[model samples]
Target: MPRPASDKRERLTEAAITLARAHGLEATTLAAIATEAGVAQGSVYYYFKTKADVAQAVADGVAESLASARSTLGPEPTDALVGFLGAYVDDAAAICAHGSLLATASAGTGSDRAHREAIDWLAERFGDLGFAAEAARARAVHLLAGIEGGAALAHALNDLSPLEREATHLGRWVANASA
Candidate 1:
């Protein structure tokens, strides 16, 4: 029996993730994704209009996973921020081995939306703690920048220590909000 269309799309998205991790998004091609997915090149086009579409699919998957992971974050602002950073770093550690995939995913619309949501959530947490709206948003942006930069550094070094240190540092900054 023939597989379902969603199955093929899932296979294609998985293949895209694999290829993007192994070769970075710029180096990953539709043909390569098709080959990796055990589907014809035409099948790739059937599911996605362009490479960016496939990258978007990958980004969507990442966002979904991170959202699920974040459901358990502690209520406190500092703890929540630390937990959020930990979740992002954990997710990044998986794909950042090759490094380019995380960077590429970060550029996608789905990832961008997820990032914005995270910033909003964190900002709200800060607001709950009495921070001004502008200050809360600024802090959220700064923490997110550190998370992204730390992931990139972790990818380059093939070690997660840099990201860990960043989480710790950012945790301190969030904690200082109480002072």
Candidate 2:
């Protein structure tokens, strides 16, 4: 039986994400993803026309996962912010641990969508805390930059406690800023 289009696309996306995490995005070629997914090389082309497309899909998947995780933090604003920041720290550390592959992809061209999505998500979350739009945007950027920097440092040191600590600090900062 032929595989459903959605299933094939999902398999390809999963394979791409896995390979990107393991080998870095630059090394995760269509052929490699195809092998990983047990599909033909052309199968990947059917869903994603280029490496950037696949990378974007993987990044989008990550964004969606992060959003879902944040949504599970219940209805409390403070709890949600803390939970989201914690998850962000963990996720950033994981991505950084993927080394140059993920780094390259994250820093590579066409990552504007990922960055914008993240900023928008953070802004919305901050807005939930009754922050003015401008304040929320600035705080969101500050928090994300801090988390990204801290995560990079922690990943380089092979210790995530610092990232966690930094995230906690930022969370408190946000709480105060919202007051």
Give the winner by lDDT. Answer: 1
Give me candidate 2's TM-score against the actual structure: 0.80
RMSD of each: 3.4, 3.1
Q: Which stretches of candidate 2 lie over 4 Å from their true place?
A: 1-6, 89-93, 97-103, 106-111
lDDT, candidate 2, equals 0.73
Candidate 1 residues 66-167, lDDT tens each? 567667897877778778876766666463542355457766544575567667887888887888999888877888778777878887888888888887
Model 2 over residues 50-162: C-alpha lDDT tens digits?
87788777776655655567668777767776776777666764555433443465665455544566678778778888888898888778877787777767777878877
Q: Residue-pair clashes per candidate, as listed?
A: 0, 1
User: Against the unseen true structure, what C-alpha lDDT does each candidate score?
Assistant: 0.75, 0.73
Reference-based TM-score of each model:
0.79, 0.80
Please give the TM-score that candidate 1 achieves against the real structure.
0.79
